[model samples]
Each structure stands twice: as structure tokens, then as C-alpha cells.
Target: SLILTESRSYWLASLTFLLLFSLMSFRSNKRLILTSAFILLTAGAVISQVPVLKDRFHSITDTKNNGSNITRLMIWKSHIKAFTEDYTLTERIFGAGDNASKLAWRHFGRAFQEVTGKEEIPPPGELRKWFHGGETHNLYLKFLTKYGILGLLGYLFFWIYVIYRNLERRDSLFIKAFVAGYVGFLVASFFENNFTDAEVQFTLFFILGVNFALISETAVRQR
Candidate 1:
């Protein structure tokens, strides 16, 4: 898990997959499976309410809490403003190109200073060392900032195309599993840079490949 949000996404997706698997296996016991799922969910909810799990499921819209969500929003705003305010019309349409997210984060640091004020960050010429690392944290923004609107649209088109092709085989177990995993990645990407994460990226492509394999095998059998 790269972060709390990503971890939650993974858990949710895995749980969903397991439930589906159970349902598929217990075709005659659908009612029993549904009852079990409900009970499990209720127990999990109660457990998560304990003090030990206080911050586990942080609110997505919380602005007052010292959660990473706020800073992520700031980074999003910073990059959007950085591109819109500074870039020329052509640059906005075509993007600045290469490591643009790195530059965007640099601007994000300044944006934080301006938005949050000097109190949040150390004052200029202050005698204190600061360690900071920055990223767009959102893959969509990262792509848009690095490659502009056209780039974002093209990436989305390819993504939707692959998923659409796989979805045509709704009867395939592997395809259903891949869809669940893909949806998980899509949800997680909103909160973290899942595309840049090696584990997440590997898992995403692996599931996709498995779906293709299942499709091919089915085709061969049918022929």
C-alpha cells in the first residue's frame, strides 16, 4: 500500500472480488452468501470505529484535519494554476513537455507558501533545515500538466478501449476479475500516483494480460 487511500481501495477491491468468487462458487446458496457478506461488513464497520482505527478511514473532504488529502488538493490546484496562469495558449494546448510534473511540484511548493502562508512553512532565511519531496499525486493531473488536454484525452481513450474490449467477454471469470482490479486502480489513482507505483502498475497490467489470455483461450475453444 503506497498510502491509506490506496490501501483502502485495494482492500475494498479484494473483498469485492472474494465475494464475487464466493457467489460464483455457491450458485445455489446466494441467500447464504448475501447474509454472510452483510454480517461481515457490519462487523468490519464496528471494528473500524474503535480508537485504534481512529484515522484509518479518513474523510475525503476533510479540510481541517492534518490528513494528506488537503495537501493533495493544494497540489492539484497549484498545478492547474501553474499551467493556466503561466503557460501560453500553445503551451496550454500542447504542454511544456518532459518532467513537467517535477516543475509543477516546484510550483506547488510556492503555491503552498502563498496559500497556507509563512506560518505553515518556515520563513525565508530561517535557520532550520527542511526535507521536502513533491508529486502531483493525481495521475490525471500529472498527465494533463505534462502533456496537456490532448494527451489526457488520448490516454483515457486507450484506457477505455482496453477495458471495453475486455468487457465484451462478460461471461469470462478472469475478465470479471480484471474489471474489478481495473476499477480499483481507477479509484485509487484519484488519491495517489498509482500509475507511477511499481507494485500497482505491475498488478494492473498483470490482470489485464490475464484477461487477454482468458479471452484468447475462450476464442480457441469456440473455434
Candidate 2:
């Protein structure tokens, strides 16, 4: 499970390598099989230890965040109310921009404090200072508010293109495996704002791009 937590991509990549090695080993390519397995294993081990790297790996898996998780859901519910109050086609498509976060903070913070009976303040030290405005914790909503409907459409389109181009090739098992893992990550992003988190976004895009490249190579070989 820990290994699974480390990286969905790595796990998928390792599986692909193992499958390929198993299939090709019968051809007496002992050295090639050993080299590929060793390299993949080393990479997976090293990546699991790096702080940011590990976060990306874990992002693909669902983590229980205790009770604190509901705050965002509550905030989202409140946001829906605010959006309904306005209910303009313009607001729905273009959004109210940074103002939405402020509105959410005021409503959600007050509610949170009232319910929990705790005064909310920024945390101690640099982290608090850096984040002058508290986070919404929902990347899709954040982008929607900031960039509007057109931006959301463009963003989704880009990912769709990436997935389509990468997974279209049938020749490479590695590409196929990576795409499978990526699809999992994409699904998780709906519930969690995975793209807003730097670590998650980086790992997701990197693997997607890598898979695309692998697929391209395989297509070339088949031609």
C-alpha cells in the first residue's frame, strides 16, 4: 500500500516494465531485462523518499483528512448559495473573480467559527504571512472564479487532448499502463483539487507527457 501511495505512475511504469520484460526475456535478453528492472526499481525507491515527489505519488490515492475535510464542502455549499443569489449568465460564465474567495471566506469562516466555537486566525510564522488570503481548497472553483467559463473549457480541452493523444496508440504497453494510471488521477481530481496543488499537477502532467512520448515512439516503430 505504501508503495502504491508513493506514485501511481511509478507503480504503473514498473508494471509495464515487468510485463515487457516477462514477454521479451524468453528471447535471451537477460542483460536488457536486468538493466531495465534495476533502473525502474531504483527510480521508484528514490522518488518515494523525496518530499514533493512523495506528495504527488500520494495524491493519486484517497487520504482520510479526519473531520476537518468538511469545511471545504460547507464552503462550497455556501458558494452555491452566493452564486444562486446573483444567478447571472455573466457570473456563471465569467465569474466574480477574486471577490468570490472573499465572499466564501466571510460566510464560511463565520459559520465555521460559530459551529466549532473557535476563533480562526492565521497560523504562526511564514506560512501564515505568505497566505494573506485563505485558500478555497477547490481548484476548479478557483479557476472558474478567476478565469471564467472559457478558461475552464480551455483547461479541460487541453487535458482531454493530452489523454487522447497519449492513449490512442496501442503498440506500447508502457504508454497504456501510464494512461491507465493517469485516468485514475484525472478521476480523483474531480473530488479533490489535485491540479491546484503544485506537486500533484507536476507529477500528473509529467507522466502524461512522458506517456505521450512513449506512445509516439511506439507508433513510429509500428509504421
Candidate 3:
């Protein structure tokens, strides 16, 4: 259900991490993995030249965002406005509730109109058309609106800690793989909702778990 560009970003980033791992690996199978990746990358690039497939290349840097990005921008602006002007101190400090931004947008539709200088309320059908299914596309903003500064700080530091933990040991193949994958995930997350999507979130945790296992084994070996 994700955009083609988004899926490409995720998988390409993963493949890149794996490819680098193979290049650096001493294992016998590294050559096989490298050969396979090269073939697929080459085939995929050639296929993109087909008339039906060329638009995807433009989509990679499309500032207009194929319509979705503008809608996201509007929703983000609306949410930031509502969070600042429409909520109580307690609600502001602790957020309205978990997964409640959509609800906030619904309840605070008037606030959005006021902030955006559009006084007309859409019909119920129209409401579903424009505002439904929108979340804070950016996770930091989501945290700021949901759980205030403390939550935002915690969220930021969590990744910092993860990166630090991985780097504490000598860089091994698995460690390099996780770091590269995690870096890509972070970059993609800024533009999309990685946490809300089940598959993306699952893959994120899978990366974390692999890193944990790798780091633990390395620690045991050192002992």
C-alpha cells in the first residue's frame, strides 16, 4: 500500500547495506551475493527506461510530491497550529492521547480553519475526503504534539543510544549492516509514517533485534 518510491527507498537501502557487507566480508558466499545484487540492480535500472516506468525516476526528486506531499504539508501545518492554540496546558504537556492526532484534527477542525483563515466547515463526506487518515507525517512533530518536549527528547535520545550501543563494539558485518539500514530508515521516516505502518515498524524492530544479538555475542566472545 506504500508508494513505489517509498518501497524503493526501503529495499534499496537494505540492499545497499547488504552489498557493502558482502564487499567487506571474508566469507566464501560474499562473491555470490555481490554477483546477484549487481544483476538485479542493473536489470532494475534498465527496466526503469520503459515509457511506463520512467515517471518513477522523476518521483524520486519531485518537489510537488505527486500530490501526496502537498496534502501532507497541509496536514502537518494544521496539526502544529491545533497543538499550539487549541489544547489545554495538561493536554499540551501530555498530548491528547496515543494515536489521537486524527481525532484532534477532527475535534479541532474549527481551529484549523481559524489558523488557516478558512472558515467553512466541510460537509461530513467532504471531511472524509480531505482530512481523514492524516497523521503527523513527521515523527518529532507527532511526539511534540502528543507527549510534549519530554517525549520528544526521549524519542531523539533513543536512536542516539541505539547508534552508540552499536558503535561501542568493533564494527562487524552485522553491526555495519544494522547501522546502514537504520540510517536509511531514519531518513525515510522523516517523510513518511514508518511507525504506523506494520511492515515498516516490524522491519525496524527486526534490525534492532539483530543488532542486539550481534552485540551480545561480541561481548560474550570478549569475555
Candidate 4:
């Protein structure tokens, strides 16, 4: 019995082609490659924005019953206040560990009450709670709260190394594509904790590790 089965093969294939095209664009003046990549990205973005597509996507992931947009907006507003209150040198450097949620809740609770003027209203449930949901739903913020400044610096270093190596290669299409796709992930991580989930974490680390390994192999072959 196979423990794992690959799902969404079509989507994965599209992403693979997109990554390849993005990388090829870096080393060659190929308009077709760039155009193909742009079309793929635009198609994915447009599909994501459509209500029916969005609903279907959520349903596949079992997130169909998630909170409404208004609730999320309110939570984010409250979260901004909490983050500001807790934004300190110590918190920025050493992080708050697993206790970040409790601290955020206390801070946001006060802010929420003050803003809404509701005395007995209960705090939002698991879906509404930032930490309960496993993070603040932001990768940068999550790193700040969990790993602190030092960790963030280390993380940035890894990315810099990847980009530097890619730039040094004159005709490496794979390197270019990997870096471009990585940048895309970085952008998306700002609004969502894309790295916090186990599945995502594994995939990210696997891709990065493979890219590094490939680069190393190429260097060895050259030597």
C-alpha cells in the first residue's frame, strides 16, 4: 500500500513548466518563455480570484467553512494593534516562543474590547485566534515571534546564498527558475504562513535542498 499519492498532478505540472520558463528567461532573451510564464501566472491568479474557483479550491482543502472576510479583516486590525504593543527590541531579537499567542490574545482582547465597546463578547474561536491557527498567518511575523532577529538573519542569508549562486551561473536555467519561484514564495509568505505547515515546509526544504545539491554537483563536474 502506497502511503502517499500525488494529488493535483495538473496543477503541479503547470507549476513545473512555469518554474522552468521563469528560469530560462534569466539566461536567454526568449520572449516566448517570458510570455508563457506570464500567461500561466495570470491564469492562476485569475482563477484564484473567481468566487467559484476560490470556493472549489477551498473545498478541496477542507477550508470551505473558514471565517468570513469581515471577520478576518477585524482580526487583522486587532492584530496590528497587538503587534505594535509587543514590538520591542527584546521581542524582535529573542522572540516570544510558544507563548506568543497568549500574549497576543491578551493584547488583542483589550484592543478588541476597547474598539467595539462590547463587555461580554467572547474572544474569537480557534479559527479566529492567531496562535491557535498555528501562527499569525504571516511568515515574517511568525519568524520574528518564534525565531527572533537572529533566526531571521540566518534565513535571509540562505536566500542570499541561493540568489548569489544562481547569478554566478551563466547558463543555468534551473538555477534561474528556482530563484524566481523562491521569490514568488517569499512574496506570498508575507500574507500567509506558507512555511508553517508541515507539508509546505517539507516541500520547500526539499526543493531548496535539491537546488543546492544540483548546484554543488555542477560545480564538482566543472572541477
Question: For each predicted model, how many residue pairs clash, with residues at least 3 apart or on different chains?
Answer: 0, 0, 0, 1
| Local distance difference test, candidate 1 | 0.63
Best by lDDT: 3
Q: In candidate 1, what are the lDDT values of residues 91-195, reduced to their tens digit? A: 677776764655565466566665555446555233111212446777887778777888888878978988787777756656655665666666656666778
> What would the per-residue lDDT of candidate 3 be over residues 4-63, giving only the tens digit for each residue?
344545555555555555654536456657675886677467647665446655565554
Query: What is the TM-score ranking, best to worst?
Result: 1, 3, 4, 2
Give the least accurate 10-residue stretch of model 3, judged by summed lDDT: 1-10
Instruction: Write candidate 2's Cα lDDT for 16-69 as tens digits.
Output: 545554444435555666776787677668767787666665554432432334
The segments of candidate 4 whose C-alpha lies over 4 angstroms from its true place after superposition are: 1-38, 41-51, 54-80, 87-89, 109-134
Q: For model 4, which pairs clash?
A: 23-177
Per-model TM-score on C-alpha atoms: 0.72, 0.55, 0.68, 0.65
Residue 40 displacement in candidate 3 (angstroms): 9.8
The prediction achieving the highest TM-score against the true structure is 1
lDDT accuracy of residue 76 in candidate 2: 59
Error of 2 at 179 (Å): 1.9
Local accuracy of candidate 4 as per-residue lDDT tens digits, 1-223: 0102222323444455566555557457577576876777776676677776555445434422433332333445555555567657776677767766656666555544554555655646732443344346567777766677787787778778877887776367677777667766666565567777999999988997898898888888889
Question: Which of candidates 1 and 4 reaches a greater TM-score?
Answer: 1
Ranking by lDDT: 3, 1, 4, 2
